[model samples]
Target: MDVDGEERIAAPREVVWHALNDPEILRQCIPGCQSLEKTSPTELVTTVRIKIGPVGATFNGEITLSNINAPESYTISGEGKGGIAGFGKGAADVVLIEDGDETILRYAAKAQVGGKLAQLGSRLIDSASRKLAQQFFADFNAAVAADGQT
Candidate 1:
């Protein structure tokens, strides 16, 4: 599966970047995310409850950052296992650019799934992934804006 998308946040680049990396902001933005922790400057550990169609599982994963350019761009790759439900791994290249006072967040991501998830078919996976990504960014934008207002 591949995901190519972008969102323009109505905030400064610095504000967008700060919200992007903040654990609290991320947890609130990521759907089904129960916990997220920064194990290292370039690594994150996460736990999320996922439900696709009739399958539900808890995924515990670690994500590593590479090709980082700080507040501008980075590459993230992560793999997660949900017991018998199977495993998922994905890589995304994210870029951020200033658009006046706003920041545009662009990303290209590819993913592979195995086990029960793959059995559900590509259409389902693709739809779910896009929905999740959209929700995350929407939440992120709202959170960032709220923080600025307060």
Candidate 2:
């Protein structure tokens, strides 16, 4: 499945870009993220707990940032394994455009899932995916915006 959207964050592009790379900020922004450890400048290992429908699972994943353009844009990719629950892999192309004092954060993401998670039906999975994405960006936007205020 694919999902895309944009958020207007009340912060400069540089601030938003820095927040995107901060493990602490990302851990707080991501829904269900249990832990996020930065292993390298562009790589992180994470654990996230999520429930879709009635199946609840903990996913261990690795995230990588590439195609970086510094304070501008980058591609974020990750894959997670949830044991019997399923496996998921996805990539997102994120672009940060400066809009005066704020930043317009746009993303195009593609994802795929297998195992029990896929058996849940496409409609359900798609809906859940969109909701999760929205939640993450909303939280991220708020966090960055609040930080800018201080």
Candidate 3:
């Protein structure tokens, strides 16, 4: 599945960039993310719980950032396993464009699933992925805006 979207954040590009790299901020913004630990400047280990259709499971994953260009752009890829539920892997390219005091965040992502999760059908998985992406961005925008105010 492919997913892409853009969001306008009421903060500077630098602030947005920092928030994106900060594990604490990411943990707060990512939907279903139970914990996120940054093991290195370019890698993070995470635990996330999600429910799709009639199945619910917790997934452990590692995400790595590459082709980083500071407050400009980067590519992130990760894979997760949920035991009997299934597994998922995906990659996203993110760009941050400065718009005066605000920043325009854009992303293009693709994901794949296997096992029981894949058996649930593409339509269902696509819908769920889109929703989760939307939620994460909304939360991220709000959190960054709020953080800027403090």
Candidate 4:
């Protein structure tokens, strides 16, 4: 499944980029994310509880950041396993563009599923993924805006 979206944050590219790399900020922004640990400058490990339709599970995931261009663009690869629930692996290409006092964050992401999660089909998976992504960004924007850090 594939999902993409763009959000305009009322903050400079640098500030937005910094927030993106902060595990504390990410832990708060990610929907259902109970914990996030920055094991290194380019790797993050996360634990999240998810509810899709009637199925609920906890996912443990690792996200790796690469192709860094400072406060410009980067690529992220993530993989998660939910035991009997299923597993998912995906990668995203993210570009942050400067828009005066704001930043335009664009992303293109794709994922592959296995186990029970794969039985749900692409439509359901795509919809859920898009909603989760949207919620994360909205929370992130709100957090940064609240701090007046952007």
- Name the regions of candidate 4 deviating beyond 4 angstroms: none
Q: After aligning candidate 2 to the native by TM-score, how far in Å is the CA of 112 from where it should be?
A: 0.3
Q: What lDDT is obtained when candidate 2 is compared to the true structure?
A: 0.94
Ranking by TM-score: 3, 2, 1, 4
CA lDDT scores, all candidates in order: 0.91, 0.94, 0.95, 0.89
TM-score of each: 0.96, 0.97, 0.98, 0.96
lDDT of 2 by residue, 52-130 (tens): 9977899999999999999999999999999999999999999999999999999999999998999998899999999
Q: Which portions of model 3 miss their true places by more than 4 Å?
A: none
lDDT tens per residue, model 3, 1-150: 999989898999999999999999999988899999999999999999999998889999999999999989999999999999999999999999999999999999999999899999999999999999989989999999999999
Tens-place lDDT per residue, model 1, 1-150, is 999998999898888878877888988898999999999988999999989888889999998989988889889899999999999999999999999989999999999999999999999999999998999889999999998777
TM-score of 1: 0.96
lDDT of 3: 0.95
Residue 108, candidate 2: C-alpha displacement in angstroms: 0.4
Report lDDT (Cα) of residue 3, candidate 2: 90
* Residue pairs clashing, model 4: none
Model 3 TM-score (2 dp): 0.98
Ranking the candidates on lDDT from highest down gives 3, 2, 1, 4
